[model samples]
Target: MAELMEQSLLAMREGAQATRDTGAACDRIGSAFDDMRSAAERLVDTAAEISTFVAAIDALAQQTNLLALNATIEAARAGEAGRGFSVVATEVKALSTQTRKVTDDIRQHISGLQAHVTALVETANGVGARLDDSRNATERANRHIQDVEGAVERNTASMDMIAGLIAGQKDATVKLEEGIASTLTHVSASEIFANEVVGAVSATDSVVKAQFASLEAFEIKNYVLHRAKSDHTLWKKRLAGMMAGLEGLRVDELVDHHSCRLGKWYDHVADPVLRNHPDFRALVKPHEEVHVRGREAAKRYADGDLVAARAAFEAMNVASTEVLMRLDRLIAAFQ
Candidate 1:
């Protein structure tokens, strides 16, 4: 009978070990869920940043519409002398309207993607909760097994008395078997839960990959300083266009130091070493001067001060040159 009890106790120990292993598996699954949730959150942030870019594009479109309206008014004042200008204004207005509509569509799509990613995060949280519950149940089963082992050990220590307490020993063995059976059931349940969570994580990973693929185009940072230089060149052309009355320019279209692409990058750059570069620090003041003078140029032309407008445009050109030179230095340093 003692020998039989020893075998039963051994089986119960194995069952307990299995339960502990399952609990460890639950912990691992919970950790994976946490990682998934964190990744989903990062994707959501990326979508939000992209949405901000779309908003900037929309703002530019609205500014274009306003400029077109002003052109329309100026053309009206010019009467028959403005007939060609009026046609151009109508076309620009139509184009701006179409651009606004397209941006609106893009915003809706991004919002939908954000909603989906948020749902993915919530689902990951749910899986983590389930894993916690599984771990708790497994722990309870392990405790039960430990109790059964203690009872068997006590029975074994009093083996000489077992003949007189045969019935009691048999009863204890039956209880030990029942405890191990219960523990095995708990282990099986935990295993099932872990499998379910694995499937969920696999599905979430595919979704995250697909979402990342969709957003790959927005990571447009290659040759960013070069682009900034080009933006300044374009601004110069626009200023000349305003002076010749070849284009309608708004003072607000000369966005401030913080609103341009380079400004956005400068504000968000995570590398302290790059951000603290002397050339990087020097780019800001001249950049702001360019915008301030560009807007002044536009305002002067609007106020019919052609000479002051030309002077501001010249000053803006000088500031833009400084900005470009600093950008070149920074770019070369990086290269």
Candidate 2:
């Protein structure tokens, strides 16, 4: 039981460390996305500038067309003597018409490109926002884990104190037994000491029970795995909600494997023999794949690739099943 408490505390600390690393990774990702969005914005601005330049060319084309029309009219008034000028004016007007058509085509293409660039910016911003939210959630989880670690430490101290007291009582009881038949007065004192020993034993049993109960309440293996499965389910549901136009769903809220309860337990398996168990070793790969696939699904969905998102989600489900199966086997081993 003491060993288990120590392992749990170690796991919580390791989990906290994982969260900090995750937070750092999130910051890096957010920075990259910010750079990407900025570049996209710059592209949008460049597109706008190109569109403005095209518009100016379009206006110039229209003005040239008008001037060519006036030239054609003047050449017609001059009749046969201006025939050459009339032909030149007609060619100029045709050229201007082609110029306007070409400018219109360029403007249309620019508009489409600009629209796509703006959408890219929006997507990047959305990703960054979600990352920030995830980071904040991770930090909160880390703080809570730290609190749990502190509590476990205090409980360990209390358990150690109780164990020491129990040991002292055992020693006293041994000495009392050695002199039990020496004298009546000694026997009487032994009786009182035996009563005291019984009370101490009872108290020790209560303390042990209480400590075990507290550990049981953690529901270690099965409970952690069950909650992990539930967390994944909730993540998928929230992602689906977001895809369905629901508000307040953030893909970043989905935690990575290491920051999860099961992950923590797996990382800090203090029992060397258990750590080498086949099921325990196999569990990590599937567990990690589950989180990876889940994140991929969320990212694909966020990027508006519904088909890919569904495929990734299906993969995640498969991995999650494997994870649960392995976890079950591992739990059975523990039992």
Candidate 3:
């Protein structure tokens, strides 16, 4: 049992370390996305400036057209006196028409290019948003792993204490066995000897009770934490689906969907058992803060305040992973 427990502990430690590494990688990825988003925004701005230049060219084409018309009129009044000038005016008018057509074509192409750049900017924003959320989730997982490690450390200390008590019990049992053998051989067991055996048995009971109580606590911890892990996974899957459904849902619908998800998790999975655990109880205020902020983010989104939503989501996401990982590790220990 000891060897098995040690192996399990080692595996868990390795897993936690791996998860921490993954979180750091996720943060790096998020940073890269942020850089990309900034680049995309700059591209959009440059494209907008190009669009302005196109507008200026369009205006210049109009002015040239007006000038060509005036020249044609002046040449017409000159008649035979300005025959060459009339020919030149005609050429100018044709050139003006061609210039206008070319400018119109340029305008169309620039408009298309602007649309594509705008779309690229929006795409970058969405990807950055998702990456930010992923980073937040990973960070939360890392924190929960830390909490688990702390709890495991405590448990380890408790196990060491229990080991000491067991060692004492083993010594007492050996002495008792020798005493029994001596008593049988002598055909006389003293009251003092009987009292010593009784004392040892009582000590055994006391140690068992202490260790048993701790082990029993694991039962409840195991159940709740296991349920929490499952629920966490479900919550993530549901959130992913809701995000994918963004195209079909309006702001209100999106908020409602997310709110309902949180509510169900709170009511059935989190609130029911989590609110009661001392560790989870301590986690409550922080978890509640995350939910409150997330709700605010949803409200901000509904109000057409994307910047506020993104900021709020970032805050909430960090808190969420911390809470989640704590719960995850608690359950993991029991398993």
Candidate 4:
């Protein structure tokens, strides 16, 4: 009876040890399943993030296509003036098409990955949940795994936005380069036109100077006689008539004013002749009497003689016309 009791106790101990070992194995398997479930969940989350990113990329590609189409239409409408812009617009369209293709490929790949991840997560969940019921330690580890998966998903989204911004910036740079090239071409053409204008203006100036230099030299004796008739004799007659028209004519008053007016006429004649024909200097007197006999005539006009003023005005007009005619003839000989 003692031996039988001892054998029964040994059997019981062996059975308890087997159950403990089996429980430990189940615990390890649960832990492994939890790890696999977490990995599969993370993979699924990654695929979902990639799908969202790909969708966004597709949307952007659609927008780019619309923009490229608009640019192409605008360029075409501009005709020959926008030939350079048309080329750029064509390039933009090609790039947009290529981007659409890439986005489609990405979307297809992400969809496949998401399907695979979903299957894996389902399998892992089944195994982990069964193991967790068998052992409580696996539940704690599963929670920690889920936290890591969430962090990875958020980071992926941020990276997608950055990539889109970079692509947009590249397109802008291409347009800028095309605009600068067009501006340079326009500036080059303008410079050529400006040079042509300068050449034309220089030729015109040369022609004008040549024409001015064709003046003939006048004889000193003829030039002096012409000045004496126009400035002295003709001007004296005009002054005398003006004096007679005035009511309160005085000889002294006429001499003072008439002398200065006559002097101005002499000076006008002398200046041009002296400068152009220095040989005529011998004909000009240093102290000539410009007033002549007009003092008494001018005095009559100064004394409020209206008839003398009218006669003087008429005489001055006639003499001025004769002088101008002589100048015209001399200028015509030069031409």
How far out, in Å, is residue 113 in model 2?
Answer: 2.0
Cα lDDT for residue 19, model 1? 89
Model 2 vs. true fold: TM: 0.49
Clashing pairs in 2: none
Question: Where does candidate 3 stray beyond 4 Å?
Answer: 160-335
Deviation of model 1 at 322, angstroms: 99
Task: Give the higher-lDDT candidate: 2 or 4.
Answer: 2
The CA-based lDDT of model 3 is what?
0.66
**Tens digit of per-residue lDDT, candidate 3, span 184-244:** 7666555557557655754664574465456555646454444445444444333333333
**lDDT per residue (tens digit) for residues 1-335 in model 2:** 66677787788888889988998999899899999999999999999999999999999999999999999999999999889999999999999999999999999999999989988998998998899899899889888888888999988887778878888899898888776656777779978887676556546645744654576666475555555555555555555555545433446777788987778877877888888889888888988888888788778887889889889878887887788788667667766
For 1-335, candidate 1 gives per-residue lDDT tens digits of 77777777788788889988998999888888889999999999999999999999999999999999999999999999998999999999999999999999999999999999999998998888888899899999899989988988787667636665886679889999999999999999998896676567546645754664565567644367776676667677778767867578988777877898778877888888888999988888998989899999999999999999999999998998899899989888987
For model 1, what is the error of residue 142's alpha carbon versus the real structure, in angstroms, after optimal superposition? Answer: 1.7
Among the numbered candidates, top lDDT falls to 1
Candidate lDDT (C-alpha), each: 0.85, 0.80, 0.66, 0.59
Worst 10-residue lDDT window, candidate 2: 241-250
Ordered by lDDT, highest first, the candidates read 1, 2, 3, 4
lDDT by residue (1-335, candidate 4, tens digit) is 33444454455555555556666888788788888888888888888888888888888888888988888888889999888888888888898889889988888888888888888888888887777676554344344444544444444455556667877899898999999999999999988886576567546655644543342153443443344343444344345434433133345544432245334444566456433653233223311322322443354456666566555455544544554454445444444
Judged by lDDT against the true structure, how good is candidate 1? Answer: 0.85
Cα displacement (angstroms), candidate 2, residue 271, comes to 92
